[model samples]
Target chain A: MSAAKKTALCAMLCAVSAVLSTLESALPLPVFFVPGCRLGLSNLAVITAIPLVGAAGSLSVVAVKSLLILVTRGVTAGIMSISGGLLSLAVMLLLFRLARFGFVGVSVASAAAHNTAQLAAAGLLMGDVRVFSFWWLYLLLSIAAGALTGVAAGVIIPPLGRALGAR
Target chain B: MKKLSKTPLFAAADIFIIALVLALAAVPFFISVKGAGAPLSASVKINGRDAGSYPLDNAGEFKLVGENGIEMTLVVDGDGVFVKDSSCRDKICERTGKITREGQSVICMPGRISIALEGETGGADAVVG
Candidate 1:
């Protein structure tokens, strides 16, 4: 992809991810009843970007989202989101490259990774690993959230590729 | 990235992954629920500051003043510690009921107050004279 085109794609992906996260936070779902649990909706944009933009562009996508969060939430929240988002994006990229894991499986893995990283970050930030007590429930919810995002990605990616020649 | 597969989104590997994650998450959850030590004391914190610490041996009650002059009445009984009365509108602290084990806490977010039950230091308690 050309420089301008790459920048445009990265910008769009970042905006899409930020919007998805904002929408997710606005909607209070009981599914997130467990502490440190979110739907990982923003993962969709990053996953889609893997096949569209290269790894570098996708990394920027994650960075932009974290920066947006840092500005809006606070320093601590920004740190947590960056840690979790980067890990999740890396795992998803690896799974995509392997070509063995399917949509649901890869999404589930990324979501699990995201939750694990967030839990670890929170434990470190508070100076108490006991915060990991919520770890199990967070991962359990990841399965469902990942599957949902995977299905969403599946539904959107094909149409998007055809429309924009993403590949 | 690989070619986006045409197969159904839910694959057999997905089941295995889900099962693996579920099992992995269950271990810590059950351990935390088991809570090794016994309840010994109740530590109160208002907005991340230690308000007071009290032994949970006998029944007692006290008022906790939190941010914005939010007042809450904490009751410590044999069962554990809980919020019996709260000036906060939500009353979520009261709704949390009682906390009887270590790491258990009743938190009032509106007031930024929390009453947490601290368990015994070790599995066995030392009787010091």
Candidate 2:
């Protein structure tokens, strides 16, 4: 694909991810294990962008998504979102390099890494390690959240790639 | 490039990751439960410094000032402690709900404050002699 086409596709992916992120926060999920934990539905677009737009494109999607959260949530939340979103995209790229793992594996691991990174960021910002120990349940919830996003990505990515004429 | 496959929602690598995460997730629960007893108090920390600790039965609501001049209202009751109000936008601390178990806590990341339930430190392995 041409550079312009890739840019357009990345922009579109970013828009979709931003919408997903907004939608997720608006939905009241049946979660009690941890505070502020969501199903990471926004990550579905990033996962789909992995094969269609590769690392750079996916990174933009994550960046835009975080930026949106920062504007909507607050400064601290924005920082956490960027840290978590970047780490998540990095993990997804690394998993894609394996070339054999499915979307579920990558999305699941990415979701877990995102939550871990955010908690770690919160701990560092607060200058405390206790946050990790206190919020261990967040990691446990990542599995189901990751699978949900992965399933959505799995259904959308193939068709999206074919339509976009991507590699 | 090979596209992400859908037939197998979970592959060998996914299973391995799930196992690893599950084991990691269980570690904290084990540590928290190992030395716990009936919680008797709640301790509040702001910006990594201990602000104060009160009896679990303190049964009153009080405000705390944390880093960045963040204000949080914490409620301490007979059964548990929780954030009644917070200045942070997300209100995650407020949503953490009441924590009753020893070693459990409610934290406000934006406010840089944490409220943890504290209990007596004793175990069956302790020897009277």
Candidate 3:
């Protein structure tokens, strides 16, 4: 793919991810373990974009997604989103490129890392370590949600890759 | 690249990761559950500093103020302690429902108040990794 096309595709991915994020938040999941936890459906696009547009393009998608959240929400929300997004993308890139792991492993690891990053950011901002106390439950939820998202991505990515002509 | 007959949903690495995460998630629960019968004590902290603590055995209410001046009313009634009310925008702490067991907590993020039950099996056990 040409550079211009990759940029346009990444832009399209950002828009799709932002929409997914917004839509997923509206979902009334039967989750009571962690109050603010979601299924991480928005990560589907990020997982798909990695192999399609490479790390740089995926990073742009993350940046655009964070920017969208920053504009709509406040600064703290923006910070959390960016921290989670970037950290997760880094993990995904490493696992996908170096380890040659399938989409499932990469996406699941990325989701878990994203949650950890968000928790770390919140703890630092609040100057509290008690936040870590909830690690057990949050980690479990993140992994479980990550697995679900990873499976969904695995099911969709092969076909989507063929459709988009992505490696 | 070697063409595989099928795209396996879970590779060996994926199973290993899943097992690792499950083990990590289970460790705390197992440790905490061992002391489930321990007495319930409310440990209150404001702005991450130790504010005070009260035994849930005696039912009463106490108001705590965060550094940001957010007011939180903690009520300990028959059964357990819970956040009766909070001044924060979202009543998440209030809606956290009643926390009766050990290691349970009601944290008001925006209010910067943490009300956790001091469990006997605790003492940096949950913070290991």
Candidate 4:
């Protein structure tokens, strides 16, 4: 793909991710196990960006989404969201390099990392280790939802990749 | 020369790291297994008007008025807090479960209603800020 086209695609993905995150935040899932966790649909954009734009591009998308949410919301929520996004991007990039487990594995791994990162961030900010007590249930939910989203991305990315001729 | 094609040690390190995270995630279920009796009781007010005080005994049922002139029943158990019933088309708040412990919250975006377990900032335990 041409440089201009690649930039546009990346921007579009970032926008979609931001909107998804905002909407998901508004609609909090009533999980039976983990109380405060959500599906974090924006992560789909982050994971897909890994294979397309590489680490820098994926990180850029996360940064953009985090900043947008931070600017719109206050610092408390922004800090937790940004921490999760950065951590998810880091794990996804690493896993993408190591194994060809396809998009499904990447999504699941990123989602797990996202929850872990958020809980860790909360513990750190609150100065209490008990904040991490919700990790198990949230991680399971993250993995399950991440796999679902990753499968959807896997199915969608190929055609888009071929049409855009993304290498 | 064929013996030099060993996989990088970093790959093994990655597997180890992932395993460690999964294990850490499971620790919560074991540690938080102790059922914490109702740790909080407070009055919920909207726009300076008395909605109601959440009863500590049950800790599973409460009421609040929404912006649309409708009432919402909230429930909290050991797991979390949630809206048992609401008049909104979107049952988003109902999906967010009941939060009993400190630092957990359930919000009704459309109704502009929020029920939160106040952090250790102040209560009967300490002076309110």
Candidate 5:
């Protein structure tokens, strides 16, 4: 309810999201598919923060989580991770502003944006535009995964928001 | 907010797309194996002296020798190339299995090592770059 309470709650959410992301990073995927390519469980915090604390708060949470990861993981992977986070946050904020499609829509958009950003980064890093040939496949995958995680976040966050009381 | 319900349409779409990807991934396996490209043999020279040669075999195995008499085996498969056996921590190179496509690479940061596949495209419908 109070501004102070909201700030504190945002901070806590960011911390939780960082921890979730770190854990997700440890899970192994196939060798061809890049690891840490998943829209982390911590993104739930970002989705929740969007509606509860507004765009600024949501962006803050994303920035904090990315910064924490960057510091811990070092620069090589951190650069791409941060880029993806920023892109996801931007997409979620845009969707939240444009349509009242609720959390599901925002989550899907964020997920799609996240994948797009990563693929874009990969293309640039590898010095081959064909890298984006895989974008369509990854985009589809991100939407599915993003929707699943977004829905879960939508259900869980309101209560947590209430318990934490308007932060 | 309305209670979220699972939509059959979404599920159907998911299955269709997944099947499509599986099909795409499998095409390479079924196609006839073209003769292996110019065996990736080259005397890896750092400055002038020989570092080693990556004798690319049709069976997809190569030998990597370092300046200090260290030797490693690199294996390439349908999936990608990886250091089958290496005396390096982080096993990053080992984990980066054979890369058959252009722009894909496996880097061993500690060993200052890199194994990459260049000028080759994925086994999909030939969409030339």
Candidate 6:
């Protein structure tokens, strides 16, 4: 892809991801077990972009999405989003580039990284490692949720990549 | 980057991760669930500080004032403890419903208040901090 085309694709993926993030946050999750847990549908764009546009493209998508969230939500939410977003993006890149994990593997790795990053951010804000102990259930929940979302990302990425000519 | 391929949805590696997740999920249940007759309690905290502790069996209502002068009304009954009302705009904590199981929690982010179940089985006490 030409430089201009690559930038355009990144822009489109960023917009799609931003919309997904906002829409997911607005909806009432039916998950009773983990109150604040989400499906992380926005990751579809990042996962799709990674194979096509590469690691830098994925980071740009996350950056734009988090910026949109910061503008719409608040500073604290923005901070949390960036922390989780950057960590997960890096993990996905590493898994994809080094581990030769398929789309599903990368998706699951990123999802777990996202949740762990959020937990670390929360722990830092509260100045207590015990914050993690109190929320240990979320660790298990993250794995299950990650797998489910990973599958969703795996299913969606192929067609989306075809449209973008990234795959 | 490698070209994408159309592999089976549930690849062998995917199934492996799924099985690993299932095994991890079961550990928490086994570790937390034991001796049902044990009494249950709830710990209340505000801004990571201990607010108070109340037994789930007790039937009563009380008010918790948080750091920012935020107020939350906690009601406890046979079912469990819950937030009946809160000064926060969203009222998510109030809508979380009663938490009866061990390790369950009702958290009000805006108010910085958290109420978590305390099991008499000597499971670690729940605290926001």
Among these predicted structures, which one has the highest TM-score? Answer: 2
lDDT of each: 0.75, 0.80, 0.75, 0.64, 0.58, 0.71
Instruction: Return the number of clashes found in candidate 4.
Output: 8
The DockQ score of candidate 1 comes to: 0.34
lDDT of 4 by residue, A78-142 (tens): 78789999888887777666664556666777888888787677656544444454566677677
Residue pairs with colliding backbones in model 3 are none
Q: For model 5 chain A, give the 10-residue run with minimal summed lDDT.
A: A28-37
Report, to 2 decimal places, the DockQ of model 3: 0.34
Please, what are the lDDT tens digits per residue for candidate 4 over residues B41-88? 434545334455464445567677766565788775544456778886
True contacts kept of 4: 0.09
Q: What share of the true interface contacts does each candidate keep?
A: 0.43, 0.49, 0.30, 0.09, 0.00, 0.18
Q: Please state the error at residue B37 of candidate 6 in Å.
A: 4.6
lDDT of model 1 at residue B40? 72
What is the TM-score of candidate 2? 0.90
DockQ of each: 0.34, 0.54, 0.34, 0.10, 0.10, 0.26
State the TM-score of the second chain for every model: 0.70, 0.81, 0.73, 0.51, 0.44, 0.73
Worst 10 residues of 6 chain B by lDDT: B120-129
- Rank the candidate models, highest DockQ first: 2, 3, 1, 6, 5, 4
lDDT-best of 1 and 2: 2
Clashing pairs in 5: B80-B97, B80-B98, B81-B97, B81-B98, B81-B99, B82-B97, B82-B98
Maximum-lDDT candidate: 2
Once model 5 is optimally superposed onto the true structure by TM-score, how far is the C-alpha of residue A80 displaced, in angstroms?
1.1
Candidate 2 has a DockQ of 0.54
By TM-score, how accurate is candidate 3? 0.84
Winner by TM-score between candidate 6 and candidate 4:
6
Per-residue lDDT over A1-167 for candidate 3, one digit per residue giving the tens place of the 0 to 100 score: 67887888888898899999889766647664465677888898898787778778888889988898788765667888999999999888777756546656776788778888887887776666666666777777877788788889878877766676655
Candidate 6 residue-wise lDDT, B12-122, digit = tens: 665555455456546656665553545887887777777788887778998987645678889989878888768865566676678787667777654566677777656
* Clashing pairs in model 2, backbone N/Cα/C closer than 3 A: none
Candidate 1 on B9-117: residue-level lDDT in tens?
6667678778899899878655554434465788776666677887888688888898767898888787688887688654556765677777666655445565666
